[model samples]
Structures are given as C-alpha cells and as structure tokens.
Target: MRLLPWTGAGGKPCYLSTDDPHSPLSRLADDIEALHLADAAGVLEGARAVLDDPGAGEHAVRFALARAVESLGDTLRVAVSRGECA
Candidate 1:
C-alpha cells in the first residue's frame, strides 16, 4: 500500500493499494514531495515571519498556514509510502 499525497474530502488519509512502485501516481507523489522539500526552508521562514508579526494581515497568515498544512500532509504521505516499502 502506498500513501497518496492528498487527503480525502473528509480529511482522511488516502492509501493506494498496489505492488508497483513505478506507477504514475507514485511518480507524481515523488515529484510533489521533491518540490515541497525543495521549498521547505523558504516556506518555513515565511510562515514563521508572518506568525511572529503581530500586525500581519489575516490574509497573509492564512496563506502561510494553508501552505504549511499542505506541505506537512505531502511530507507525511511520502514518509508513509516509504515505510510501506521498508
């Protein structure tokens, strides 16, 4: 079973039960994971800065938070997928 990079509509973890690691979905997940990791540092810093500022606008905070949550979900999916292989 492989964990997909996106959650279901009900906020549940979605898993792909398959033996092929080279499937299209798996490759897409890998790409998404790579992109997230590459931008992690910048996103973390931006979010931290926005959160630390007392006068930051709600829009800025919300955007940062949304990105953080999405990135976390993607990272978790990748980890779960790798663990299944292990």
Candidate 2:
C-alpha cells in the first residue's frame, strides 16, 4: 500500500531512509536480483521443487536465500560508508 502519509518508525531488520537507498526492502530486492543474475547458471533451478514442510530443509533454503540478499545489502552499506560505492 502506497502511503498517502505513512509514518511508522521502520523496524530494524531494515534500515529506513527518507531516500530509497536507505530502504531495506529496496536494498534487499536489488541484492537478491543481483545474486540470482550473477550465479553460475541454474544453481538455484531446483529451489522451486522443494516441498514446504516444518523441517529445516525449507527453513534452510529460505534463510540461505534471504541471507545472501542481506549480505549484499550489508556489502553495499559498507561500500558506501567507505566511499567506494555510488
């Protein structure tokens, strides 16, 4: 939902920004897309075939994906902080 006047302190899994670069969601999406693009072709092709279950298999798969994306965001944050990223 696009906010007409949204006002909520962005909770910490993401960094909030008045600018989009500081938005964790934006950063996460970009990182995931990049990781998926930069892979050695079809590495993740079987992710879709995994069945949903209470076992750690599903959680592991999901957490790994999310962690990879978050790592990218973290890298970007560090890069920007070091004045190395645009």
Candidate 3:
C-alpha cells in the first residue's frame, strides 16, 4: 500500500496497493512528487529574494507564504507516501 499525495473529497487519505514499483499509479505518484519538489525549490528561491529585498510588498510576502505552505504539504505527502512516518 502506498499513500497518495492528494486527499479525497472528504479529506481522507488515498492509497494504492501495488507490489510493482513501476506500475502506472506509482509512476504517476513519482511524477507528481517530482513536480512538487521542483515547485518547492523555486518557491524557496523566490521567498529568499523577497525577504532580502527591503522594498518587498505585503502582497509578495503573502504569496510567498502561501506557496511555502503548499510546498510543505506536498513534501509531507511525499514522505507519507514513502512510509516515512512512524
């Protein structure tokens, strides 16, 4: 059983049962995880630049914060999917 990155309609965790790591579902999950990680890296770079700039506006800060939260969630989901949680 492998946990999925996204939740169900009712906020329940989604799982896939597959012994083959190269299954279609597994590949899909890998692709999503890669995308999330890439997004997180970009967001972190942008956030750092925004924070370093004294003239940064409230809107830019808020956007960076929101993106950070999303990235965190995505990272956590990937961890859960890999059974990293105890």
Off by over 4 Å in 3: none
Model 3 lDDT per residue over 1-86, tens place: 88887789899888889898899888988898899889889989999998998999999999989989889889888877778864
- Cα lDDT for residue 64, candidate 3: 88
Model 2, 1-86: lDDT tens digits are 11211124673333334456547665665565455445513333334333343454857787656655655555555445435676
RMSD of 3: 1.2
For all candidates, the clash counts are 0, 0, 0
lDDT agreement of model 3 with the native = 0.87
Per-residue lDDT of model 1, residues 1-86, tens digit only: 66777778898877878778798987887787787676676788899999999999989999999988877666666667678433
Using TM-score as the measure, which candidate wins?
A: 3
TM-score, candidate 3, is: 0.91
lDDT of 2 at 71: 53
Per-model TM-score, in order, reads 0.60, 0.34, 0.91
* lDDT of model 3 at position 73: 89
Better of 1 and 2 by TM-score: 1
